[model samples]
Structures are given as structure tokens and as C-alpha cells.
Target: MEIKEAIALIHAEGLQAGTWADLGCGEGLFSVALAHLLPPGSTILAIDQQPVKPLPYSIPAGISVMRQQADFSLTNFQLPALQGIVMANSLHYITDKPNLIKRLAQSLTDDGTFIIVEYETTQANPWVPYPITLQALTELFREAGFTNTIKLGERNSVYRSGKMYAARISR
Candidate 1:
């Protein structure tokens, strides 16, 4: 989905402000978009395994953006306590999804939200190491102690003809 659509969906979900993170933020598009959606003075940590280039758009006032280079799949990596986290088109690359999800959950505040955008198919490929269906994702989050999960939005995948879904999981 487009960044605007994703931002609109996040706004509709009552996400007004907080310390947000965009894990595996490739070009920082969503990270920038989120900065605009959040309340003033909120911070966004845009992290990626590879170095991320500077954002193309103008940052809104009272928002701080921090760029970090780290491999999230590594067990030694640490995450700060956050009010919200977004993993868009990135979780599929991890081989151990359950562990990562659990670790991410632990890093969140009590009422924190986790947003994910992923393929809806169960098929696996080289690029998608751990293809997880929507049902499976919900189950995984439930197993990880997330009590509330919502399907925020869905659209046809630009990489393929299949469908993709954006979900929100909260503790």
C-alpha cells in the first residue's frame, strides 16, 4: 500500500502520538509519514540493517528522527521501550519469527502497539523466508501475549499479484 493510505489507516486507529519506531525502514518513507501523523515532539527511530539515506520529504516541526544501522535478526541487538513499532515488508526475512516477535513485544510499553505489513500468502520463497498467513500472524501474536489484533488495511501486492495485509497488534 501507499504511504498515505498506511498513514490514514494508522490515524483511523486512534494513533495520535508516541515514541514510534520503523524497524527495517528501507528508504524511511513510512518513518517520515509516521512523523507527520504523530503528535508534536514525538520521536521516530528509523532502523535498518543497511544504512538508510536521508529522507526526501521535509520533517514536521517538533519531531525528531534518529537513523540507526543494526541487524535486528541478531540476538544481541537491543530495542528501546516504545509506544509503537512498525515492521513493513521486513518480518518475512527473519527465519525465527516467533522469537523476534516475542523480543519485540518485550520492548514495547504496556499499552504499546505493533503494526506489520506483510504478504498474505502461506507460500515460501527465497525472499520470503517465513511466509505467514493472517491467521498464523494472529496466532503468533496471541502466543506472544498480544490480546488485541486488528486488520488495519489490505491491498494487492506490488511485488506480486497476491494480496497483502496491514495488521495492528496491541498488548
Candidate 2:
């Protein structure tokens, strides 16, 4: 998807500028979008196991981006307390969703935001090995101690038959 579409998926009002981590930030598309939503002086930790290319879109000034080449799915992985976390099209790669969500919840500051962009289907394909439908996602986050899971937006997928949804989770 394009940068504008990515931004629309997760945009919300009253978002403050703070440190945000984009796990599995492939190409930094959603990372750039998150940066735009936050106020200036925010920092985005664009992380993936592979090297992330330079951001394709221009972020607001003073929004710094730090790219980290690490596997975020690992249980032993360490992360600082963050105001927000974005996982776009990345959670499907993980086989154990509950533990991963619980671990990530611990990484967030109180009143933190967890944004997920995923396909709204249960059928797994070669690309999506462990798909989490919206219903399953809500249950998973609820089990992880989150109190709310609000769907921000959805769009028809150009590549897949199912729709892509973006949801904001909170404690």
C-alpha cells in the first residue's frame, strides 16, 4: 500500500509525540505514517531482522528514526518502554500470539497504544502462515491484558482477497 493509505489506516486524534517502535517495519511504510501522526520531536524505532531501507516518505521535522536489525518475535528480545508500538503485517509470522502480545504489552508505558495492521481473514497462505482474523485478534489482545481493541480503519487489499484492518489496542 501507499504511504497515504498506510497513514489513513492508523491515524487517530490526540496522539502525542513520543517514542514509538514499529516491529517488522519492512521498508518503514507504517513507521513513516506513525511519525506523521505524532507531534514533532518523536522517535520511531524501525526494526526488522533485515536491513530497512531509507524511509520512502518525508517525515515531519524532528521525528528521528532509528533502524534496528533484530528479530522482534524472540521472547528474549529487549525493548525500552515506549508510548506506542506498531505491528503491520508482521504478527502473522509468529506462531505463538498470546506470549508475543503479552511480552509486547510489558514493553509499553501505561496508557500506551498498540496498533496492528493485519488481514481480516483466518485462511493462511504461503505469505501469511498464521493469519489472525479481527475476532481472533481481539480475543488474543484481551487475553494479553488489553482492555480495548478499536478498529481504526479498513481497506480492500490489492494483493489479497481479504480486507486489511488497522486496530488500536489499549489497556
Candidate 3:
């Protein structure tokens, strides 16, 4: 199926996360959006190795945005007890992808889900992320410890130009 079609399949199921997270959140778009995806009173933890950047300052009230400057590759720091969703967009920027995800997966509750969005290799942008195709999103999540994974379909990714793809993985 088309990449966008695949991602749409994932997002359409809707977000059931109570406490969500977006690891490696660069600009915070995916993190912010996922925060909005949750039911009211839900919290989202937006963790990044980079220092927090200036966002609109004005954000949704219920969402608890947590920023982490520590390197996620290190097996240090406290993982959150999350019963919601976690997302990763364009993870190719990660130097230690496996370790980084192992830490992230450790945070997932049995009821939680992990959403990943990456570009289809053929359509990946050459300037960003060394242009690695986001198609291996499933394998990456499996390596991270997601036992139950399903192709959630693709959508025209706002994350990039060509096509925005998405996948849903869970414990």
C-alpha cells in the first residue's frame, strides 16, 4: 500500500494514551500533536537530548511537557511510567538508535502504544537524517521491545515533503 495510506491507518485508530511521550522531539510538532491527541487530563512527556527551544509559549493547558537534556543513549535517568502513547519521528538522527529505543521502551506500560513516523526511503529528503528511509520503523520498534506491532498505514506526512508515514507498535 502507499506510505501515506499506511500511516493514516495508524492514526485513524485514535490515541488512547493517558500519559504520552515524544522522544528525540526536535521542534516538538509531533510531541505537541500527540499531546493534543489524548483525552483531557492526559500528560505528554517531550524528551530531547537538545536543550529546550522556544516554542509558542502558549500551549494546551492539560499537557505536561517534560524536556530532558540528557543523552538518551546512556542507560541513566528515570523512565516514566506511561499508560499512554509514545512517538518518534525521523529517528535517523539518532546515533545510538537501539540503545535509545531500549530506554524509551522501558517506559511503556502494557496498555501503552508507540507511534513512529519516518519517510519512505525513496521519498526521503536528502538534506535531513542522511536520507535514510523510514521504512524500517517496524524493525526499529521491535529492537526497542515492542512485541505487538501493526502497520497503521501512512499519511501525507507533515513531518516532510514527499509523504508522511506512520506505524503503531505496542507491548
Error of 3 at 122 (Å): 7.1
Q: The CA-based lDDT of model 3 is what? A: 0.62
Candidate ordering by lDDT (highest first): 2, 1, 3
- On lDDT, the candidate that comes out on top is 2
- For model 2, the stretches where C-alpha displacement exceeds 4 angstroms are none
Q: Report the lDDT tens digits of candidate 1 across residue range 54-75.
A: 8776779999999899888788
For residues 1-171, write the lDDT of model 2, one tens digit per residue: 888989999988777678899999989999999988998888999999997677777888889999899999887899998999999999999999898888888989888999999999988999899999889999999888888889999999888897999999998
Using Cα atoms with residue i matched to residue i, what is each candidate's TM-score against the true structure? Answer: 0.91, 0.97, 0.70
lDDT of 3 at 111: 70
Colliding pairs, model 2: none
lDDT of each: 0.83, 0.90, 0.62
- The alpha-carbon deviation from the true structure for residue 85 of candidate 3, after best TM-score superposition, in angstroms, is 5.2
RMSD of 2: 0.9
Clashes of each: 0, 0, 12
* Candidate 1 colliding pairs, count: 0
- Model 3, stretches more than 4 Å misplaced? 1-14, 122-135, 143-147, 153-162
- In terms of TM-score, the best-performing candidate is 2
